[model samples]
Every structure is written in structure tokens, then in C-alpha cells.
Target: MYVGEMGIDRPRELPWQELVLGGTAVAVLLGLHLLPDSGGVDPVYELLSEYPLRSVVVGVPYTLALLSANTAVVLLGVAMVRQGLLRGWLTTTLLAVWCLSLLGLTVFLKDPVGSAGTWYGTAHKLCTVANFVSLPALCALLWRRFRTVSGWRGNARRVGVLAALSMVCAVPFAAAFLRYGGQLRATGTVLGLIERCIVVLDIATIVTLAAWSRAMAAARDKRRFDHEVI
Candidate 1:
């Protein structure tokens, strides 16, 4: 992949994408939650929240601490993108940039050059909206890669399909479940628990898969050595 005409080689960037998305979603939720005791999330309140979402609302700075923190995380993703996978990484990186830029609008809200208020909110919403598009881009890449993988894994076809679909929906659905989850959930903590579980479970699964693959390769080597000695 080329960033400003520089070539970058990244490997297994799906994990990176997951990390960044999870971070951004969590940051936004936490930021809003920490604000002085707001009643249960209401549409009218949400609308009002957006009204003052600029950098200089009432001549005071907005709470951009979390948003800026997310931008730093996004930059790390960009920096790390130079390692084997392309299709998933490329699409994900693009979506991430867009999302970060939307959030960035707030940091510049008061500046003469910066966009603020509803415009920034609209852009932020737009970037979040584009997340659905990112899903398809990643799915296509995974589907193509799946087609190429040597059928070494049992049920290769099924695994490929599932991976492609799971990755695509992971971010977007999680966002929806998070934003509106309180209403549908019996307890507000359910979504939080679910998010934590998903993060831990997914990371553990990927690490386990990597370890298993290495073990298989080692076994293959040992068998070859035995045959050669015999």
C-alpha cells in the first residue's frame, strides 16, 4: 500500500483495525457517560448534546480529551500499516482516517480554519455512517483472500465465509448495539459486559490460532526429521 507514495507492507492488520475501532467507540461512550449526571439517554438530549459539541461553546473549550486521544490511536494504526495484508488493511485505514478527521473537527471548532458545531457533528455522524461501507470493503478482501488460501484448514470454505462476514459486521453492529443498547438491554451493564467479552474472546482466539498453527508446523518438521532418520 502507498501512503503519500510510500510503499507499506502490513501483516494481519485485522487485529489493528479491531483495536482502533473498539478504542474509538469506547472513548466516545466514556466521554459522554462521565459528563455531569445526564438523565437516561434520550433523543432530545442527544440532539441537544450535538448542539454544543464544538470547540468553543459559550467561550469554553469542549471536552475533547477523549476525542484527541482517539486520534493518536488512529495515527498508530497508520504507522503500523506498513507490515503483509493489503485489502483489509487498506480499506480499514481509509475508514479510520475519515472517522478520525470527523472527530478532529471538534479540536478546531473555534479556530477560524476549523469546522465546529452541527457541521462537525454531522461530519462525525457521516464518518460513523461510512463505517457500514468499510464492512463491505473488508468482506470483499477477505473473500478474495479466502479463495486463495490453500485448503489446509478444515472447512476452509466455511471458515473463510465466516471470517469475512464477522469482520465486516464487527465494528458497525457493535456501534449500534452500544449506542442504542441501553434501551434494548435489561441492564445498562449488559452492553459493557458484552463489549469486554468480545474484545477478550476475539484476541484470545486469534492468539490461540496463531499458536496452534506454529505447533502444527513444528509437528510437521518433527515428522520430516523422523522420516529422514529412518
Candidate 2:
């Protein structure tokens, strides 16, 4: 079936791979918080980037998590293109930018909390902003595209919810950062918690889309087999 220029047929099934990649990302992210020597950083006010700046133990896992998450997103984007869930060069460009921004995170370490600004830190901040903005925008576009498709309506709803939740958390996160001029500790806000929530939701969105694509592909294959047998 075709919806405008988007094709929704014969989706490829690769949910397990995506799950493995995304799961690794989430697991490492969660594990960072439990590290005994995590800089004595306050999870409520400090950002996840603080861990690497404080402890070498956290840095390796943090880099691994970002790499894993980036791979998962790249795979998901390819699947979306194959399944016709994403259309147009504009969306494709956005996805590429998002993936590159994610990769930048791994390459450029964030500025240490309350440290003098450096060139790498500035680049990292730009990448962070681009990563944050692009994913939600992509999700919004996907939700609009998927809602009308027969097999994708449910996935559309799931994407919508995840995107909405991430955006909701982002408002307070941004507000606190701005209100304190990026001094989150002085703002006394749960910036870390809020950022964590957004990351979790974004990961969930990727997994949900992967699972939905797998299910739809399976259903399509079964129907084709049954027709051939008959």
C-alpha cells in the first residue's frame, strides 16, 4: 500500500538487533548512576556528562552507550526508509544530522561542570542541542505520517506519546538551565532527572518503532505465504 509518496509494504524485520543495540545503550546509561565513585555528583541537579568529567570508570561506559544508541538510530532510520515510514529528502537530511550529532557527542566531551569554556566544549554543546531538537522533530513528523497508515496507527500513537513526554520534560530542563544561566546546581532543579527521562523516552521511541516494523513485516510475510499456498 502506498500513502502519497510513502510506501508501506514488505517492511524488513530486524527488531532483535535494534533491541540489542538500544538495550545496551539504556543499560549503560542506567549503570552510570549506580557507580560508587560517580564523582559524588547529585543526580538531581548534575547532568550525565558530569560522570565522565569526574571519573574515568564512567567515561568508557558513557562512550559505549552513545555509540550503541547511535548505531540503533542509524539502523532504525534505514528501516524506516525501507518500510516507507519516512519520506522525502528533508526528513532524510534531518535523520542524518541527528545521527551525526549523536556521533559528535562521543567524540567531543562536554565541558566540565563549572569549568572554563573550551573549543571542544562549545562544539559538544552545539551537538547536544542539535541532537535534542532533531529527534523530537523527526518523531513529530513520523507520528503525522504513521497515524493514517493501517498497520502503523498504533506505532504512531506510541511515538506521539514518547515525543510528547520528552518535550514536556525538556521544557523544565530548558527553563532551569536558562533561569540559572546554565548553572543547574544554583537553579535547584532536577535537571539530571529530567534529562534522563528524555533520554529514556527517546530510546523507548526507537525500540517501539523497531518492534512495530518487525511485527508489520512478519504479518506481511505470513499473508504472502498464505496466498501462495492457497
Candidate 3:
């Protein structure tokens, strides 16, 4: 019997459109740091949110990049669900929370460094924490799911590694905030550097998952083609 006739679900390929969108978002985010209007803030000491407030040049692009990234993530999550990679409501909820937190980051910009926190700023901080917390949890879930599926163990290990790195990066990021009593001006800690590393790993994890789905789809097609030829 064919794979489908044997009650196996074929992997759902992530669309090229989603990959392009995600790639564009990553490019834009990385490119933003190169702009001349960055307000002279030290990247190692300060947070990325400080950039947008520094100038309109950075603000507009930063907002657009985040929105694009959020959209790409939502599309990817849906693809994973259809592919049976996200098998339960718990995983679905985690994906939703991560996406929503990303949206919140765009909507409620953090307060300027060393400034008093406003309501929106407080909300922004909450969302930042949520975003950091949720993505790694989702990666852990994906790792568990991928480990059991044939042809997916490599990706499972990759995702597990990314999740571990994310958690490790979060340590210093969190410590900097806690040391400052939840303030953003922890100059002694490499808060910006750690945050940047976490962001890169998070994006890399998403790309890895997308690559896994695409690879599975290709392998499934090849198996079907061979079965038909035989």
C-alpha cells in the first residue's frame, strides 16, 4: 500500500512564500543595526527597543520587520499544525502566545532607557518576557514531536540544541534586569549582546523547522514516486 493508504499522514511543505517573508524579515532586522541614525547607543549595553525611539528612520523599519516576522511565524505555525508537527492544543496555545507577544512588542514600545515606566511600557516589558519564554518552550515541544517521527530525528536534535542555547542566553538577559530591579540600564551586563544572540537563535530555529518540513515533503514525494514506478 502507498504511504497514504497505510494511514500515514504526509508532511505538509511550508510554502515558498512564507520562507521568503521570513527571510526578508530577518534581513531587515539585521540591516537596521547598520543604519546611521541609531542614536549612538551602545549595542552591547542597551536593548534593541532603544533604537526605534532614537529616530524615525529606525522606528518605521523596526515596526515593519517585526510585523513581517510575526506574520511569517503565524504561517509557519499553521503549516506545522497541518503537518502533524504541532499535535495538541498545548502546542497551539504556545504558538499563539508567542505570536501575540511579538505583536505586542510592535504596538507598545518600551519606555526610553532610565525613564519612568508608563502603562504601555509595562505592557511592553511583559510582552518581551513572554516572547522570550514562549519560543523556547515551543521549540522544546517541536523537539519532542520530531523525535518520534521517522526522518525527523536530526531536526529534533537541532531544535533541542537551539532551545538549550536560548535558555542559556536568557540567563544573563534576565540577570541584568533583575540586578537593576527590572530597569533597562544595567550597563555592567552585556544585555544587548545576549539579547541579540537569543534573537538570532530564535530566528534560526524557525528557519530550521521550515527546512525540516520542506525536506520531509520532498522525501515523501520521492517515496511515492518510487512506489508507483515499482
**Top-scoring candidate (lDDT):** 3
- Ranking, lDDT, top scorer first: 3, 2, 1
Query: Which lDDT value does model 1 have at 165?
Result: 51
lDDT of 3 by residue, 1-230 (tens): 22454446555533778778878878887787665643455567777777678778777877888888889889988877775567789888988998999999899988776777689887887788788888889889888877887778888999899989999998667655544633555456678788889899988888887676666656766677677768
Per-prediction CA RMSD (Å)? 11.3, 5.3, 4.3
TM-score of each: 0.37, 0.81, 0.83
lDDT (C-alpha, whole model) for all candidates: 0.40, 0.73, 0.77
Worst 10 residues of 2 by lDDT: 1-10
lDDT of 2 by residue, 110-184 (tens): 766577777888787777677777777777888888789887788888888887887888766755554453367
Could you give candidate 1's per-residue lDDT for residues 23-112 as a string of tens digits? Answer: 565555455545554223322223212324322431132234335445544544343343222235575565465346445434433112
The prediction achieving the highest TM-score against the true structure is 3
Clashes of each: 5, 0, 0
Report the alpha-carbon TM-score of model 3 versus the true structure.
Answer: 0.83
lDDT value, candidate 1, whole model: 0.40
